[model samples]
Target chain A: MADASPIETHAHVLTLAEPLPLDSGRALAPVEIAYQTYGRLNAAKDNAIIVCHALTGDQHLASPHPKTGKPGWWSRVVGPNRPIDTNRFFVICSNVIGSCMGSSGPSSMADDGAPFAMRFPVITIRDMVRAQVALIDHLGIDRLHGIVGGSMGGMQALSWAANFPERCGAVLVLASAPRQSAQNIAFHEVGRQAIMADPEWKGGDYYTADLDDPRKVGPEAGLAVARMAAHITYLSEQGLTQKFGRRLQDRDAKTFGFDADFQVESYLRYQGLAFTDRFDANSYLYITRAMDYFDLAEEHGGRLANAFAGLKTRMCLVSFDTDWLYPTSESRAVAHAVNAAGAPVSFVELSAPFGHDSFLLDVPALDRVIEGFL
Target chain B: MADASPIETHAHVLTLAEPLPLDSGRALAPVEIAYQTYGRLNAAKDNAIIVCHALTGDQHLASPHPKTGKPGWWSRVVGPNRPIDTNRFFVICSNVIGSCMGSSGPSSMADDGAPFAMRFPVITIRDMVRAQVALIDHLGIDRLHGIVGGSMGGMQALSWAANFPERCGAVLVLASAPRQSAQNIAFHEVGRQAIMADPEWKGGDYYTADLDDPRKVGPEAGLAVARMAAHITYLSEQGLTQKFGRRLQDRDAKTFGFDADFQVESYLRYQGLAFTDRFDANSYLYITRAMDYFDLAEEHGGRLANAFAGLKTRMCLVSFDTDWLYPTSESRAVAHAVNAAGAPVSFVELSAPFGHDSFLLDVPALDRVIEGFL
Candidate 1:
């Protein structure tokens, strides 16, 4: 094989001229999208794939994070010879609208040159898919090879098949649900309350001030607490036990103080603190609220099967056995609905101890499944 | 029934001149225990039964909670004609050490005329049982009829049999583990962080401020967050869905802001705020730490079975099917150890959708089991 082009990210920011209508009945104007593309599109444009990211994730699918310098969130699944191989299929990933990283979000300046902040229109999964469809239209792509995602990303992939079936040839969803469960909404509510409870939040106007100035800061503590609480739900009790079972963190015995005495606590603190460095608290609130309001059935006349009626898109659904957040039962529900719709579907529940995050983790079994499905 | 003796509350405060030894090699001098007793101690003192309360629970077992004006927490199962049957058994319940209610705790005055606060030595479940043993001695009780408890209270019951086997004739433990699980400790760590993160916590010195004057406040926000996080674990995900599923609090549509639009959010916020009125934040830290440090095997040469070797206490261990906090596996582990030690042990996993708090909630099947065991 000849030497290939060095892996590079092709960035695009589409300034949609039309107002984007939202589920909340408010309209967002002049929408700008930040997206990255990898690999080459075939002459027929039949090999282009759309990749979606989970909550707290951005468009840097296979590139280094600009702020944290960490490898791309899904680098494992999108690189050469990987499940979603760059060479086999062209890939496009975009930062969701409500996110902070290079997307039109709460921090983006509005019509009057002031940050939207709390004034940003409430978005839904269908809205996010609509924005993506606009970007796809702008690229002049007739159709997509597949739409792939896990967790919240999986929700978007499902929404695409339900809302615009002709846009994609196949849908591959992992560790996701068609609707937000009551427990799911409750956790998100706690996270939002934590962000708003912070005095530094300043009603989401902290972005107007100079962030470098020590005197003015965003709600880092509140955001960190929110991250910590949400992180627990993403893992299983068995996984936590095996990972950090009552093990002291760099100590011979318990300190009996309020400090992080266990390894799990220390790890959660690091994850939370590291997150605040690259994420905006307000963005966290909007995106989670969007997720809470996502219900495929509610959007389709209170019937999940109605969304799948006469669906021609080939679909592959995979769920992790340990993922309590979006358990295998959820995957089964989707499989049952689509099967009744007479859609060609392949479903598998992969065994992985990493819980809901197994989709992003190094599960070789998942790689085989995805490779075969593609 | 002799008119039920006017439903009196026989309260006592045992003042011991001797220094109460603790697990941390520290001692509490002139220990005082606040407790309440129901029914009369039989002529032989053989009908005396000790009822241990869970964490955040106090001595008002069958009596009205003065602050919240709610009926006694276990009034459903411990009344005259109920399962525990106060008319037949003398039940004694004490507010645990390190608790804020009535007992000598972080809020109690020290010898130097200041609240103990952080100065209070961290205690263990075994230590709480030791204090109760002193109270039993003060009441001139010997060879007690039974020792019953649920959750943390259940931990105390198990410790009594393991440490002082001759003190009670029977042991009834419910919805608890012999050792706190890794997931349990992780959740507790989140709560501690939430409490300490509040600026008003003042490093556990918030109690010295004008709590009565109301000119200033303590860490109510932090404590509320802590309570909210912990409360989620007490109920099953299904229970939450059944109670409140995507229902708006008081409006027809979403608020599109940080307000609690969902019913679950409002309920969680109320639970957290109400908790701050009757609980101490510092005590939350200490008791959770004590629980995290608990390991029955560590006290018996790293052999859990050794904790029950040659035991004389008859035991009945009950677990709730839906209680993920202390699941059926934990109860099974304890049963296996006791059975191996030739202890007369009976174990059952009851069905309840209420999760960890099912032992305190309405479950008539549990009442039958407890009655038969007693």
Candidate 2:
């Protein structure tokens, strides 16, 4: 089922010929970026749109995930006749660096022929965009028609616009902030601690044996705990109440035990466990660390407006009212900065109950907004 | 320092002669409650005020904690010249059941002289209130004074007003909800899972040997992770930003590794690690479970007002504007219920940056409100 694609999609892996320079003054070589392309590149190669994937997302934009057998995360927005309109714009979604999804990440084999694990140089959102730029260059597209994303993906889109403003005609960011907040870093810190605390983690070297071996599984418990903590941040309290409330899970009464008695608990446990199967614990640590270090304003002259200075790319920023993770205020700040920089930017705060995850959900208003922007 | 009290404080343990029944239909014999009294009871015993403590809080309200040598949690509110005015009203603070602080919790010994651990009966907010009632009965205090608390402590105060309407003259609930929201349950569940995930947890039987042994420590790592996750919920995003907005922790640059690079991360790590020193992992699980099971309206015919019907006790509710844990809306709901029940009720949402922890902080407005109500 995962092999099925609604449209003709091509997956490609490109190895960089030169070492990728990192913010930590380190360099990574043999950098392999795996990406998927949907629709045809026009004769002029001017209709290409680069789609950045968020944390935990990968290169499966309009097809079923080969591992999870689930439909592409953005199939609702990026397919043919969808908001992204693959028929009109060539779509490209890549597995970000420092991710485990067929990219150069912690789980990828290094020069030593062992998994990079903790040895993988931490990559920032800008570094992810840099890799995407390499892919775009390899495809012979000098400048993209548009660059679009949400959440961490939006961070990449913003980074692209800031770092290489002339490379894209337009930028669309949704439910993302210019920098990680203290609370955001705190939550990510908890997840990292949970993963590192597990004895099974073995200093991120648990990949020595096959993870399928029951006795030698890699920090699944810790990773699941981490995921559970994070999953809560991705949702609104009202959303959780409307979905689960105080409802019991397959029982009319409390079990008087430590089982998942409440429906919310059951849902969280399932989400946590499901996440462990798809994600690498070490990769989780590295990616979250990357996000924690992201500060676009700091990268400039201590002013966010400096990041968007003299930017010609038309920008559209969308925020969800219920997104407490990256709240509407965050987007407003960015919009204000973009405005201060004299950039052509459109911003809107749409009402959604899904919180930070509203960007990925079935938001009709978001669909209309994206269509209008693109 | 812990043994030193500003006022002569007496600690007492009351053993209930009969078994105390629980919401889970289970009962425990020899139910022991540990409590501390500040100031002297008047001739009529009508000047005694029950001051309940929140989760992770204990009986030493106006004294130093025996374990950490820290000042009493609510010392500002319960001291001789404080808002609670210990000189005017005898203040009593008790260790709630299911807590590790000298209470009959998961860490307490059973009839067989073994730690109850997972065998401890799953209790509720109502059960905690029930135990408090027994303690009050033993103290020869009946139908007198007032009941006041904050956070989970506030839950006990509300439970008192509902279950024992005539037990107190007035009820003051601060920063709490009548029922645990789904988001609340989800966070608690994450903490529980983190504790259970530790290999050292050993199915809550890690107390087989001396926990002080460096080679054989009890689930401290898991408990710390759990604490880290929970500590975030107790704070507001604005408060975090104001206190530690991406400030480097005693460093000029990030190490680009899994270390506490930010001041907030350092603070959280210190908090999480320090918590494990005094808290029992299994006790943490049971207490949180109790909180998750709290639902006053569900217990009273599915209407919050039903719980307060025919109540004669005066009610004063306080909520912090930034407290997302039990937001102002929750207190508003309780206030509306009290109003519908034709009870005298006063509700106020104070502007505080501390979030849920505002109840325990030095809020001048809260001090004034408490003084005026008393």
Best by TM-score: 2
Where does model 2 exceed 4 Å of error? A1-5, A209-216, B1-5, B209-216
**TM-score of the A-chain for all models:** 0.96, 0.97
Model 1, chain B only, scores a TM-score of 0.97
Give the least accurate 10-residue stretch of model 1 chain B, judged by summed lDDT.
B1-10
Candidate 1 clashes between residue pairs 3 or more apart in a chain or in different chains? none
Per-residue lDDT tens digits for candidate 1, residues B285-345, read: 8888878878887778888899998578799999999998999999999999999999999
Fraction of native Cα contacts reproduced by each candidate: 0.58, 0.95
- Which prediction has the highest lDDT against the true structure? 2
CAPRI tier of model 1: medium
Q: Against the true structure, what is every candidate's RMSD? A: 2.2, 2.6
Q: Model 1 off-target regions past 4 Å? A: A1-6, A211-216, B1-6, B214-216
Question: lDDT tens digits, residues A1-374, model 2?
Answer: 02223686999999999988888888887799999999999999999999999889999988989989998998888877788887789999999999988889998888988888888997888888888988999999999999999999999999998999989878999999999999999999999999999999999988964534655368999999999999999999989999999999999898978999999999999999999878999989999998999999999989999999958979999999999999988889999999999999999999999989999998999999988888
Per-residue C-alpha lDDT of model 1 across residues A98-194, encoded as one tens digit per residue: 8988879988888998888888988888888888998889888878999999999999999999989888778999999988888888778777767
